[model samples]
Target: MQRFPSAISLFAALSFGMPALAEVTADDVWTNMQAQTRAMGATLTAKQSRTGETVTVEAQTIAWTLPEGIGSLTLTAPGFAMVEQGDGTVQILYQATQTYRMDLVIEGDTATLDVRMDGATPHMTASGDPGDITYSVHVAGGMTAAVSTHAPGEAPVTIDVVVEGGEAEIQYRVTEGPLLAIAGQATSLPGRFDAEMQMGAEVAGTVFGTVGGAESSFELNLPSDGFDILNVAAALRAGLSLDLKSALESSDYTVNLDFYGQPFSEERRWSGANHAHFSLDENRLFYDASGVDAGIVMKGENEFDSPVDIAFEAAAASALLDIPVSGRDDPQPFALRFSFDGLRMGPGLWSLFDPAKAIPRDPASIDLDLSGMVRNRVDLLNFRQFVGDVSGLPEPELISLALSRFAMTGAGTATEATGAFTFDNTDIETFDGLPRPEGAATYEISGVEGLIDTLLSMGAIAQEDALGARLGLGMVTDSVGEDQYRGAVEINEQGHAIVNGQRMR
Candidate 1:
């Protein structure tokens, strides 16, 4: 456990000797918001609302730096207001009369959120809509701040975020609610959600990097029934843990979902379990994520029109991804690996696909391992600057890519492959109108001919299509066993393609 100064202490340290203003105004609040946001490499601009005079402040665009030190972040919204209290505290509010929309982007992640709230009193009601919403903030002491949001209804909700003693805490609770407008239509959602989180050193470091190590945990629970959307009763519980150390970041999480429904007057049910653990550490200036494991399990009835039930389990899935920060002029190391234990489908489902059970019903596992080097490095700040501006922009590039190792394995089966390749900037016409590749690869596959024949006999594939597929396979493969074939492909420096030691082009 590590100790950090409270929010007040951090503020005081940053604003040492600054006088406490006797009066707080919207401008002051906006200035403070901008100052804090800028630390995260974000820009926030305010303008007049387009709706009416009642709307005082509208922040058009708020963009920030992306995590993993990559790309950019953008958040677009059309709401918010600045208000001052007699106690000199300021509040930022968001309430829309019509539809409320927020678009958020963090690197490759993106989400668009829409919400509506309705309350009974004018003070509780928001600007655009008729929902009762009360959002406010106050500085209780020199080092403590409290922010709260409330919505009154059949299923009332209250959320509070408090920052004190160098830590930020969030708490949320919602009671079972009735119907609320969804996508402009009234929809019933009889459910409740509750969650709590506390930010410590690790979380602060990960977000701001101005702090030291941090550790954080999150828990959530949601149980509901009478949901017509999926025609089922559903419940979910999840927990997550995160940590950021000097040169490493790690996370562990798990989630469980239970669902119940009726099929043909019979009760059908199922449960799903998911878990994941991963960690990333800095290797000098570069970073690598390894020892990652994730899995999922589903056991229940096939509630749909399918002819079989399901008892699937996919466990022991693991992966590794390496990122290089070497300059563009130098080739950077890159690699990726992924593997899964097996995929197990229930016997009933397997039988539905093959009544005679020609193929083995046992679980099938797959693995892929690849390692390579490439040239693709871009300045983080420069790339972010061009995210929303394309003209005269300089993007990242891969001038050269080389794969030193590539392998795929199908456990419990005679299906496997291995290969390597290299590509440079030089152009070669015989290489599919692209830069020609140099290297060779070999593959071994068994039971494929029998599977194709079985599919044809079972009316799964047309005879004409089957014949064409066989002819194509014959062009590259040599039969080595009853149902096994060996194939090799090579691309020479002179842009010639060789199949099984025979030059084709």
Candidate 2:
């Protein structure tokens, strides 16, 4: 379903780039579209016919092969017409209903999908010269898509999606270095989707969902040389840069499943806004995503001989990753951050484990922020060859690590730590074939004793086990205040593990 819109957008963008009206013609636009498509390593073919001021392209087909011979994709479009307005502009006209057929092959399996796009009062116009052109597209009466997918030895899945309204503006420029610079912004009104799936008599499911609205924008720079859609690595190596960002307002969905006479269902809703960003260049790749005020409710049967009725509240999460892709002699910097907060399980779930409410029902959270430098001995782009043969290639060397923040809280207990370290790759033997890391970290913890007591009272742990836990805590940490403990762990230059000045090695 998503592929349909993406393919249409790509075709529209490439089809509308034209020179100034004084030098542009219907045939020129058609020729440029085919040339651009070929440049991207895709074959676009159609029958062209011109009458008066309009040029029509029909029976259009696009074929593209996936990299590594993993798969192939083919799309067939009904047709469209490009009308030269004689006012330094071109008006693109689409039929009330456009049917697209896509075929995909992966490994030894194959799948086919047919999509019908119904548009009401859709408008698209293109202007400007070849060096810089602007295209405006608007669908005032909204659009709808009906998609049906078929695969071998599997039941067909049908999905229907409806959008209330949408609009997009695109700018295409040809730069001095023969690079194609493209930027676009788009917005869509509320949308809804419904899907149904059925396998054998024992398996069936239905999905219904609604999206509030969304806005997205992207910028891409593609060099003319080695710009092949089927060869993404080569394109990146030839200086391809892409950045994309999107924000979604809200969404709600429900899924119902039946398996072997057993029934299960789930409902989810999220408010506020969710954001995502991604960028890729020759040197590195970066991604960041965050969501707010989300929740889920599930009902089913569990192995504990209890009816399952679980719910979570105010669920939110954020994650970020930045890493280098190409190998270099010098160490490259990388960072990762992930955290989830505001997670509170429903009482029905808590009662299964703590019937007496012995433990605090506090919302749980985990956070980690780490940055480091690594020297790559092999290109990460070609990392698949070394996946199963660990000893066949030298691994990336970790130079330094900094844990600016680490925290976890749940079950009436909380813990936090911070640390920085540098690794000695030349002295791997000191750590038994591992890089020796030298650094000191400090930690603080609270409410552990009460938590252990609660567990013991609930018979979750043995009395001797509780005693041993207390003894270990006493040996490693000191009580800084009531219900509070502080400690430090260090790996010194001599390869000694020291806890509170006591060396263990």
**Residue range 26-120, candidate 2, lDDT tens digits:** 66556555544554567788888989999888868888888779989888877778898997677778787888888998887889998887765
For model 1, the stretches where C-alpha displacement exceeds 4 angstroms are: 1-311, 325-327, 346-352, 380-383, 389-413, 428-433
What ranges in model 2 sit over 4 Å off? 1-24, 67-71, 106-110, 165-178, 195-204, 223-231, 258-263, 269-271, 301-310, 383-391
Per-residue error for 212 in candidate 1, Å, reads 26
Q: Rate the local accuracy (lDDT) of all candidates.
A: 0.40, 0.73
Error of 2 at 280 (Å): 1.0
lDDT of 1 by residue, 12-121 (tens): 22211111224444554444444433432456666754233233665356655555455554554444565555454444454423222344454545554443332210
Question: Ten-residue segment with the worst summed lDDT in candidate 1?
Answer: 180-189
Per-residue lDDT, model 1, residue 174, is 15
Each prediction's total of clashing residue pairs, residues at least 3 apart in sequence or on different chains, is: 18, 0
The RMSD of every model to the true structure, in order and in angstroms, is 17.7, 3.7
